[model samples]
Target: MPKSLKSRGGEEELQCGPVFTVFAMGTRMTFVTEEEGINVFLNSKHVNFELAVQKPVYCTASVPKNIFFTLHEKLYITMKGKMGPFNIHQFTGKLIDELHEQLGNLGSHGIMDLNILVRDLLYPATVNTVFNKGLIPTDKGELQEFYQHFETYDEGFEYGSQMPEWLLRNWSKSKKWLLEVLEKNITHIKAYKSEKDNSVTIMQAVQDVIEMEKSELIPNYALLMLWASLSNAVPIAFWTLAFVLSHPDIHRAIKEDIASVFGSAGKDKMKVTEDELKKLPLTKWCVLEAIRLRAPGVLARKVVKAVNIMNFTIPPGDLLMVSPFWLHRNPKYFPEPELFKPERWRKANLEKHAFLDGFIGFGGGKFQCPGRWFALLEIEICLILMLYKYDCYLLDPLPKQSDLHLVGVPKPEGQCRIEYRKRI
Candidate 1:
């Protein structure tokens, strides 16, 4: 399914102006391009999220129909409570520890793979923040072993949904291992009490459901949650750092922002608070720019009632889609559409003006991601840690945003390396 989506890479749709239609997997998909139509597509009472994602999820994510409906409800509620802006600062301590530990291994200077560096650092840090540190082995060698299977699982996720599992032995093995790990994590969480403070993590938030065994589908639920949450966010972090570090002026600006908020690194271990994060509008703009530039190529829904959008009627049951990748590129909303310009955001009124209309890093209206706050906060801190601790820039040619994404921001493609030296 991801391969099919990648095949065209929005080129065919770009020719169709605001809207077009295509048939895939026995479904008619209406792709909405302009912000006006996108606004309608996202908010129409007739258009919905669950029905739109059910099939692909069942196929690739191993979630069956009976449990799918209830599982998402549970997740959505938990996500709102755990990942929302109200208490976003809670996750920073674990994230700081994890990022510091990973980045510390650089030992002052080295060259590294852009993809591998981000993947290894983000995955366990994410896992620990989302679940618990003990959920996966913390030692470097053992953690890498676990992440290897997760890598395979993540890499093959799209194909795994459509193709037979038997054909992809490696992804199959990795999927099994991931399920077992999640199941064990669930069991362990249910049996144990926190030795530390009583701040609720998502795993603990869902303990009632897992403990009662109301659904035997707990493992698959955990796996899907992991993928959906991390898939876009981790790559957004990669792009944010890539764009900032490669541009010396932006890099310097980001560093200055960090200096004002957290003081200089190396004097003592740098600590960040949520209030301090708000001070760095430049850093936030840079991060938002990466998300805008590398935003997901598509989002989808199923129209349940006939709806009129852009002088045309979209019939019920047709799969409706929108391309933020193209909407963000609309020159009226964003001048010089192809360039990475963080400064543009500063000139515009983000709330009252049309800028927010074009910003679809999270989805629109009712379809907006519940994890939006968590994802943004996570990226900000990761960027802060990187700039605070290292002097880094690209060594090889800069990587282009890969068309290889299944959802959210695509990963960086092409061969690229970084020359980074520890600052502290």
Candidate 2:
């Protein structure tokens, strides 16, 4: 079997042999093929690997230089302080209201592109939760425009980091516009800090950090923060919905689980609480399974010091990559790895199977995604509301995952459409 995975340009390739190098977007990266070696490298204290944002080659087109160094500590503190489980529950409730309104406007029966609808539902909810409700676009056309620009910038980053500046000029423009909007919102929040009781927002925390740091890179940091909060969420939600609805038994089981947790309320009065959501084993399992199957395939780290792993001498300055997609699918950890079985996460089996050790849906250690808890909370709310309120069916076959990028979540090759009707 070939060790190399072809790059987008087709001229360059990623070598995934026991230890091989690849030039990605003009930067050399080394991938560790063995699971034990990869685990050691990830958890090693002597290896001295820092976040990729600290390096230039991995920062991509729109990111500012040294932005991570300047903002990471403050950002981590802010996320930890503001995006706790209680806050997530409150914000998710608000988002559920918004989703219900949007669904009401769409009426009982309709065929729509799943990705587009999910994007529309999640983008506003995510922005409002992270920033404030005021930041959500009021005009339908304006919201669509913002969504398009965001998609462009996200897809551009996913495509490659080494593309010529001229080729990425439009994406840069979109990023600039996004940053400007974030900056304006941040400034507005700062100016009205005394007038309004808006202390819960992540934006407010960011403003506090900016004021304390007195950094000139507010817009740049804000852009990255916004991307972190919003990206990957909608696609994850879409995949969870698609997968659950496509499997009839799984769909019925999830609905029953939701009912058991929340009880049967009136169609207009169904309420999902934080405790109920937390207690839902099957729903959580389905979401985790979806993420394991489709989330970003690779996590990259740069070696700051030479290290030896499994008898191979890894030199300083080489990039080390580990892939969750590979580990999650390893049959040793997950029996019948290719099948979608949420029961694998049953409480009795979790510890016995050592699921956490193998699960990298969110990366491990200090660099793990800060918003992961909130992400799961938001996904739970969306899935529960969706299943409880409406009958949904995939109008098209399950879309295959596109392998265009070495990192980032797998996207559907084409639009996945679904039909939804209000439950009787």
TM-score of every prediction relative to native? 0.90, 0.88
RMSD of 1: 3.7
Off by over 4 Å in 2: 1-16, 48-51, 55-67, 84-87, 191-199, 263-266, 347-355
* Candidate 2: C-alpha lDDT: 0.70
112-188: candidate 2 lDDT, tens digit per residue: 99888777777777776666566667898987778888888787775435555467788877877877787677766
Clashes of each: 1, 0
Residue 397 displacement in candidate 1 (angstroms): 2.2
Best by TM-score: 1
lDDT score for candidate 1 against the true structure: 0.74
Clashing pairs in 2: none
Query: In candidate 1, residue 413 scores what lDDT?
Result: 71
User: Where's the lowest-lDDT run of ten residues in candidate 1?
Assistant: 1-10
For all predictions, the C-alpha RMSD in Å is: 3.7, 3.8
